[model samples]
Target: MDTSNEPHIAHKSHLPHPYDQDISHVLRHLSRITATGRKKLANSLSTAGYLAAGMWLIERNLGPDAARSACASGSRRSLERPLLGFLSQRAVAAAVAENPPPFPSRGGVPRLRTTWRSQSDFIADLINFAMWPTNYHPGYLEQRAVTTKRLVVGEDFVRAVHETAYLHTAESVRMPSVRLSLALMVLADGDDRVQRVLTDTYRGYLSSWKQVYAEVLRARGLRLRAGLGLDDLANALSAATDGVILRSIGDPHAGVVDRGRERTLMGTVALAVMHGFLEPAEDSDGLTLEQAVHARLGRPRPSGATRSDALRGERNPNP
Candidate 1:
C-alpha cells in the first residue's frame, strides 16, 4: 500500500484530489455491509482490534514485515476465533443509519485512524498496573526497538484495550471496518488488563451514542470527578444495552457467562450494535461519519471537558 495514498486519519473521509479515489474504494466496501452484517461486525470485534493496531505500530515504526511476523504468534491466534462479535458492531452501525428517526443523516461514515494514540500509552500504564496489581510493563516494553531508526510501544493495544474510544466517536464517526481490526487484536495478547478494566468500567457506555462511558471519560482525560452529560440522540441505545445485560444473565447464548478473556469480550458486539457504530450506506442521506463527528464537536462538552488526553503517569489507580 502507498503511504502517500493513506488517509491521514483513521476512519477518515476527507482527502485531497486523486488520493480521494483510494478512500473511495474503502468507503464503498463499507457501504455494502448489510444490517445483519453490521450486527455481526459489532459482535465480532475482540482482541483483533488491538492486534491489528499493533500492526499499525509496525507499519509506522517497525516496517510491515515485522508486524506480519508478530501476527503469527500465540497472541494473534487467540483473536482469530472470536471475530463475529466485532463484525456485529459493524452491522449495527449500518442498521442504525437505516433508521432515520434518531439520526440526522445516514450516509458517508468517516474513517478511523488505526494507530493507538498517546491516550493508548496511558491505558497501557493502567493495564500494566492492573496486571501485576503493583507493577508496570517495564520501560523496555514501551521502548522496544521495532526498527533501527524507531522505538515502539504497545500503541495499537488501544484498539482492543477498550471500546470506550469507539463509543466516544460512535454516532458521529461510525467505522465498523476498523472493528474487524479490533477483534483481531483482542484475540491476540497485547494487554489483558486493559480488556478487563474497559468491560467492568464502561458497561453503560455501550448503551448508545448518548451517555458517556466512564472508562472513555477517563481515556479522554476527564478526571473521575468530572461530570459528563449524555447525548440526547443516543440515550435510548444506552438504556437498551443496559437492559440486555440485566436480562441476559441467565439466557443460554445471550445470557451465558463468559470466563477469562471470553468473559471480558462478552457482549461487546451486542452493545456496539445497540449503540450505533456501524458503517454508512450509499444514497441514504449522504451523512458521512466525519460529519457526525464534526457535528458533535459543534456541540460543546461540559465547560470543564477536555479532548485528546495523553497518559502521563504510570500509576495504576486500580492497583
Candidate 2:
C-alpha cells in the first residue's frame, strides 16, 4: 500500500482532514499489535520513546515495509501529532466510561434494587464498577441515595468504606487503563489541547462527585462541620482518593489487610476525614456514634456490647 497518499485517502473518504478524520481504523490496526508493544508504550521512559513505539506499531499493522519507509520519510511528526490526539481522546473516553453519572430513574420507574441508603453505599458501588469496568452493565447499576429520617454513620457505612478502599486498591494494582492514562497525562505535559481535554475531564469528574456528595448529605439530614463547604469536602476526598490510588500503584502492599480486617489504609483515612467533616443533624434521639452505626446496620446488639467491640467487628449478638 502506498502510504504517502494517506491524507488523500481521508479526503476521498469524505473526511475533513487527516487529523480530523475518523481514526477508528487506526485504533483497530493498533489493537492488532502485540501486547508487548502496547506494554512498551505504557512503560516508555519518555514521550519520544512512547511515540516511537506507537509509530512502530502503526507501521507493523498498517503495512509491512512500505509504511515503515513512509513513516521514516519526513512523515513522523505529522503522524505523531494525530496519534497523540487519538490517545488523548481514548484517555478521556476511558475516564468518562469509568465514572458514569448515577441514574436514579428509567422511563419514569424508580430503580429500587440499586437505591443507595447513604453516601457510603453510593461511593462503594462507584468503586466496585471502577475496579471492574467490564462488569458494569448500563441500567443495572443505576443508583440514587434515597432520603431517610436519620442518617446513621454506623456498621454498614464502615463496611462500605472498607470495601471501597479494597476495590480501589485492587483497581490501582490491576487496571492497566489507569496506568496508561496517567502515562498519557504525563506525555501530554505542555500540550495545550491535550491538557485542556484532561482538565475538562477532571472538572467533570469532580462536579459529578460533588453533586452526589451534596445530594446524599441533604437527603440524609446531615451537615458538614462549621466552615467546611461542600466543595471543599468533595475536593479533599477526591484528592485523597487519588493520592491513595497512586500510592497503591507504587506499593501494592499499601492496600493489603489481614483476612476479616474491616478497614484498609484508604478506608481508615477516609473514615477519619468523614468524621472530621460530617456532623449529625440537629434532632431528637441523640445516640452515640457507635450506637447509631450499629442501629443502622440492624444487627441485634448483644448484651454487654461495647463501642470497642463494635469497632472490632464483633457485632454478632449470638456469636
Candidate 3:
C-alpha cells in the first residue's frame, strides 16, 4: 500500500491564525494572478454592498507577489457579479493542475457542500454599503444608520457556526475589548465620508474621516480592533465637524451617491476585524469557511486590451 499520495483537509476548528487570515484574505487583492500571464485581481470586491468574502481569501492565499497579474481581477469579477460561492472542485483542481499547493490532497474526494453565510456577513455588509451607497432615497439616510448598527443576532450566528459548521474564525474577528474595536476605526476624514454625510461638499467629509480615524487611534492608543461595534458604524458617523455629524446623524434628507467610490480608508476596520475588536452579536450572518474563501478570492480577470503592445512587455531599456 502506497500512503505517500494522501491529502489533508484543514477543519474549521483550526483555521489560519487570525492575523494570517487577515493578511491572506483582505490584503490578497494585491497579489498577482499568476506567472502564466494572468490578470491582477482587485484588492476589494465589485459589489461591495457587503464585504466580499472571496476577496478576503485571496488576500490570505495570494500575497503582494501576485499583485501584478490581471487574471486575478477577472476571478474577482466572477465571484462578484453573481454573488456566487467558491470555485468548483474542478476549478480548484484545474488551477493547481501543474503546481499545486503543498497542502494535503483531497484523496479525489469532493470539496463538500458549501453554505454561503458567515459571522461577518451583516456588519461586513454595512461596511460594504458604507463604502459605496448607490440608488436610494433621501429617507435612505435615516434607514441606513439602523442598517449598520451591530445586530444582536450575530452572537447566535457565531455560536451556531461553532457548533454546526465546525468553522474557526479567528478570535480577533470576534472582539473581546470594545475600547479597541471596529466602532472606533475611521473610514474617511473631511472628503472621505462616503455614506451620504450631508453631501453639501464631498471633499470635506472624506477629510474628516481620516482625521477622525487618526484621532481614534490616538484616543484609543493601540488597544482597539475592527468589526461591528456597538455604535452605528454604517451611517458615516465621524468625529469631524460635530455640527455636520449632529445634524446628519439621522437626517432624512441626503443623497445616496450614484457612483460612490469603492476604495476607502478602512485599513483600521480590516485590522480590527482581524484582531477581535468586534464581537459576534446574536444575529451575525454565518458564512462557512468555504463561503468566506470563495467570497474573498477569485481567478483573476483578463486584460481588456485587444492588441498586444510589444513595447509595454519589454523591460525599460533606459532603466
Clashes of each: 73, 1, 91
Can you write out model 2's per-residue Cα lDDT over 1-319, one digit (the tens) per residue? 1223122232222321222223222221121256655333222122112222223333332222313233445775544233333323233222322321121011110211112222222222222222232332232223212111112333366666666555554444444434433544667576554455455546766676677667657766777755667778777876777676666555656644322563457667878878766777774234444544565464865789865565456334466
What would the per-residue lDDT of candidate 3 be over residues 1-319, giving only the tens digit for each residue? 1223332322312222221122223221222455321121111111120122323323223221223323546764433321112223333333333222333233221321111122232223223322232312244435433322211123442332222111111111121111111221332223233223324223443464344334443433432222333232313333212222222222314311111331122322233332333223342323333333333342232466321222222223244
List all candidate RMSDs to the true structure.
Answer: 25.1, 19.1, 27.1
Backbone clashes (count) for model 3: 91
List the candidates ranked by lDDT, beginning with the highest.
2, 1, 3
Compared with the true structure, the alpha-carbon lDDT of candidate 3 equals: 0.27
Query: Whole-model Cα lDDT per candidate?
Result: 0.30, 0.43, 0.27
Model 1 per-residue lDDT at 208: 29
Off by over 4 Å in 2: 1-155, 184-186, 256-263, 283-319
Best by lDDT: 2
Candidate 3 residue spans exceeding 4 A from truth: 1-57, 60-89, 95-102, 107-109, 112-234, 237-319
